[model samples]
Target: MAKSATLYRMATDEHICPFGLKSKDLLKRKGYELDDNLLTSREETDAFKNKHDVKTTPQTFIDNERIGGYDELRSYFNKSEAGQQGTTYTPVLAIFAVTLLMAFAFSYASNFALLSLNTAELFVALTMGVLAIQKLRDLFSFTNSFITYDLLAMKVVRYAYVYPFLEAFVSIGMIAALPAYTVAPISLFIGGVGAVSVIKAVYIDKRELKCACVGGDSNVPLGFVSLTENLFMIGAGVWMFIK
Candidate 1:
């Protein structure tokens, strides 16, 4: 939201954000000139919100003016006079599926695995499930220091692109190398991934987003933090795939 508005302020280019990326691509496929801010700069973030005094998540602004939320964005797509240029939030559905899949899959897998230590191999699937959801969500900002306005776009990009991959690799390594189920790397990764997915998905959906990773969020895509939080786990999935 902030990224899109900031781009609007600087240029006519409209950026699509599925929560951040999924939604971003969804918009571009509909023909909007869009940029992916999955690695947005702090300046862009602050300036966008400060320019419009946005108080809520997924807020939309047009031509340096406050336009409102998802409904307004929908109107914009509809070509209403009150709306600005808009794009379809379809990618949000894909993202939603990924998130919800991990949420339910890993959650159940973990609960069942609790029955036996020998079943710890199940953790690999569970952790990878969480990783998939998080990557789709892309909430990797928490992987490093608090992102500040002082950080350059290059810095943000480095963090966004590299951190999740590393986190995922680490999770995979632990899973492959650690041999003890009692605290085996596999079980730990699965536990970490499942716990984080459900907690973040539920809390963020509860407090700021009405949609819980399904098309429902097209009405209001998941926020950056939620997406970023999931990104690490998503990267973990990538690692699992490679391993």
Candidate 2:
């Protein structure tokens, strides 16, 4: 016999519970025969809530046992919490993938070549630029998490705030093909400090922590990926200086 589940979710003219949709989708994917009960009015939703003695909508039941909300449902199924929770590489991988594709597109458009030195340069520059934007979105949060592992940020404190801006500036200079003298030093300084910090924190110290590379709110772990980012910056700096 197929498994069975029941879901009570709110769907009003003014509002629709997103967790409800997620629960419904998860049920289908898990091969559950779901009885989707929608509370279409404020009164109806509140009544259901009060009856069940629960605080939230999107309540799911398995085998007639209450399974709580979306998070609870995920827990029951041994699924990771979606978004900025626990360790994940989705954000960093996504940024790298998109930036590489963009680099290819730009290279093909400008020089009629999909792969070139320019493409490599553009990829690094674009990655830096996008990563900076992520940091800038939540400067306070980023700095708080950043200082936990970044050597320069830990000592200076203010460097945490300045770091994103520096990345942005370096990215702009690289993309604009500005004089190497103007951009290379800053890149080298930040990248060198970052690389050392990651090595000390993850390798030497053997501390496991979330990386602030993608942003302060990120769930990316501090390890090889973080080290790779710093290495890329270092490589970009040296390449720019030499060529």
Candidate 3:
């Protein structure tokens, strides 16, 4: 006889549990014939939970053995664990990946080509726009993180709040084909300030701190990546002015 599994999950008009779907898919992929039970109402769901002595939906049982929740099932199958949230470069990587694609699309649309120097400019502007959005998501948290290592932000606390807006302004202006003479100087000033702060904090001060590059929620260490972002901005500004 083939091995079989039983799953009790929540399914309703208002809410179809995502974890339930994942658990079902996992069982299917593992070749288990599932006897799926949907708890469709609040009363039914609560009664089911009480009967099983379980606090959550999406419980799985295989071969008369309880397998707990999705994470537990993954453990049973020796799969990489999921839903462990931590500080990661995921935000920055995602931003750059999307910006790269957008830059390519813009280039192809304008010049019928996928690559050009103009694409680099577009990439910088798009990247700045994305980073600005991240910072603006939780301005207070971002400001708190920014002041930790940023020299200007330490001396002038308002700079932390202004930084995102300034980044957005220069990036949007560049994207709009505004006069380089106007926005380029602003970029240079901000970039120079940022680079110096990062250098002093990481190299000179040797303070281990989180980067505010992708906002306060990021775990990216304050170092080379932070320095590189500032350098890119400075380089972009110079390129716009000269070429």
Candidate 4:
């Protein structure tokens, strides 16, 4: 027990260089102060990282709480009511889900949710009207992103979106009762097109293109980050159809 306590304290004394604001902020926010734990040596910190699965040296460990990575930290922070309630997109997400449900109904049953074709068409038109309003709301909600400074200092794209715009059309087509010949070929073509656009942007433009899909960031240029984000998005759209 004595050795364990000694090793833990020593490991946290900043590790390798004994610097960086992350460690300072972690300690100060807990009200413990730094000198309380700064005397521990560097060798022990490296040893602790090896002994445990920890990749970070100045990370927090409160009680038996999880020593988390990025994803875990996100889940923890966003799980609180304070974290969840402050979003301007709740209503939008609800409407989007409703739209998806309507789409799914139209796709699977060949009729929009228990209604006759003519009747369903009218209802669907009304739903699309609602969706148009939601889209405007979504644009407004994300408008402030233009001025926000990302800690990652992510770059914006200069030119792109010719392909993803097409893919978005195909994704809509996939859930509709378009001619089978038209449906399969167009979807595959759109997916291939999006893939090419992403690769070219990443390898050539070399900046992350933001407006390709999520219109959130003002269309960033093609780059590693943009390529990664686009691939993930395309992957997500593909994964929706395990059926």
Candidate 5:
């Protein structure tokens, strides 16, 4: 006989528990015959919670054993919590994807051209802005990770804190089509230093480490992607100087 499970979850008109849906999907995927008990009103949800002596909804039971919530169910099945740990390119890929779309959108809106030099420039600038925003979200955390591999950050700790702001400034200046004199120097300096740091840490020393490109808490590995980011800034700086 197929395994059987019971799930009590919230499904109200005003609010639906996302975790509840996740639990239901997981049970179905795991080949469990699920008894999906929906608590459709606040009173019903509260009653269910009170009766079970649980603090939250989306409770599950497998073979009559209580499996607390969505996270608990995942743990019971020996599944890793989503995006909680491990090396991932998700953040970086997401930034790139969004910036690419923005570049195309802006280019088309302004000049009716989807592909142009301006599009390329916009893509790079927007990427810098987004990446800088991620770092700025938690400057302390970002600097802690950045100092591990960045030579400038190690020698002058304050530089790590200033780095994200510099990126944001350059991004804005480039997008605004400001004179190269104002932005190119900063871009060149940061990008040059970043490229050297990444090379020494990853290529020369061969030390495996996480990147602060996305943020301090991120699991993005330090290597090619990081190097490419620096190279992009360098190229943009040079382009600005020439154009």
Candidate 6:
């Protein structure tokens, strides 16, 4: 005989249990014949729960043995726990995606062809501005985190607080299409400093630390993404100066 499972779930006019659906799908995927017992009303559902001596719906039974809830079902299959992973580049990626979209929109609005130099500049500027704002969200916290890995911040504490504003100022200048002579040098100075700091902390010192690139509270590691941000700024500044 084929293995079979029974699921007791609640499905009413106003509400249907989501976990119940998940449990049912899991059973189907595991090749178990499901005997679905859906309580159609609130009273029926309450009575069923009370009768089972359980506090929740979506209860599963396999061969007359209760198998508990969705998480429990996953555990039975030895699957990794859901939603327990650490942070990644998702935040920075999201910001970059938005900046690129904004740059395209601005380029179209200015009657410039798509993918113009102006669009590229604007994209870089907007990305910096967004990142600066993230740091400014909790400036003190960012400073505290930055001082741990930033070479300059470690020596001169005030630089930690001033960094975000400088980034924002340079970003605004680029976005406004101001004279590159003035903005480019500032960009180069800050970018060069940042790159040096990150290299010393990550490569030379081999320190494991959280990057303040996104903000102090972020879980983004102080590695490739942080280095990329500094290198990008340096590249943009160099291009602007020579162009």
Query: Which candidate number has the best lDDT?
Result: 5
Candidate 3 global lDDT: 0.90
Model 3 C-alpha RMSD vs. true structure (Å) is 1.9
- Model 3, which residues run further than 4 Å from truth? 84-87
Q: Write the per-residue lDDT of candidate 4 for residues 37-100, one digit (tens) a residue.
A: 3325566666666766787544434444544433333344454332343224444445446765
TM-score, ranked from best to worst: 3, 2, 5, 6, 4, 1
List the candidates ranked by lDDT, beginning with the highest.
5, 2, 3, 6, 1, 4
Clashing residue pairs for model 6: none
Q: Encode model 2's per-residue lDDT on 82-144: one tens digit a residue.
A: 646667899999999999999999998897567778898999999999999999999999999
The predicted structure with the larger TM-score, 5 or 6, is: 5
* Clash totals in order: 17, 0, 0, 11, 0, 0
- Whole-model lDDT, model 6: 0.88
Query: How do the residues 1-243 of candidate 6 rate in per-residue lDDT, one tens digit apiece?
Result: 888999998899999999999989989999999999999999998898888898888899997888888888888778766553676778888999999999999899999877788788888899999999999999998998999988888999999999999889889988776788878888888888889988988999999888999899888889888888888789878878777
The C-alpha lDDT values of all candidates are 0.42, 0.93, 0.90, 0.40, 0.94, 0.88
Give the distance in Å from residue 240's predicted Cα in candidate 6 to where it truly belongs.
3.0
Q: Could you give me the TM-score of model 3 versus the true structure?
A: 0.91
Model 1 residue runs over 4 Å out of place are 1-114, 118-121, 129-155, 179-243
lDDT of 5 by residue, 25-100 (tens): 9999999999999999999989988888999999999988898999899999999885457788888999999999
lDDT of 1 by residue, 1-243 (tens): 333442232222364343433234335655555433332444675676686676433554445665555445656667444332343344454554554555455557657544343233334334444443454354443332212211231355454344344445554554455333322343335335433544555454354333222222234344543354345445444444444
How many clashing residue pairs, candidate 6?
A: 0
Model 4 misplacement above 4 A: 1-169, 203-205, 216-243
Angstrom error at residue 69, model 5: 4.0
Which candidate model has the greater lDDT, 4 or 6? 6
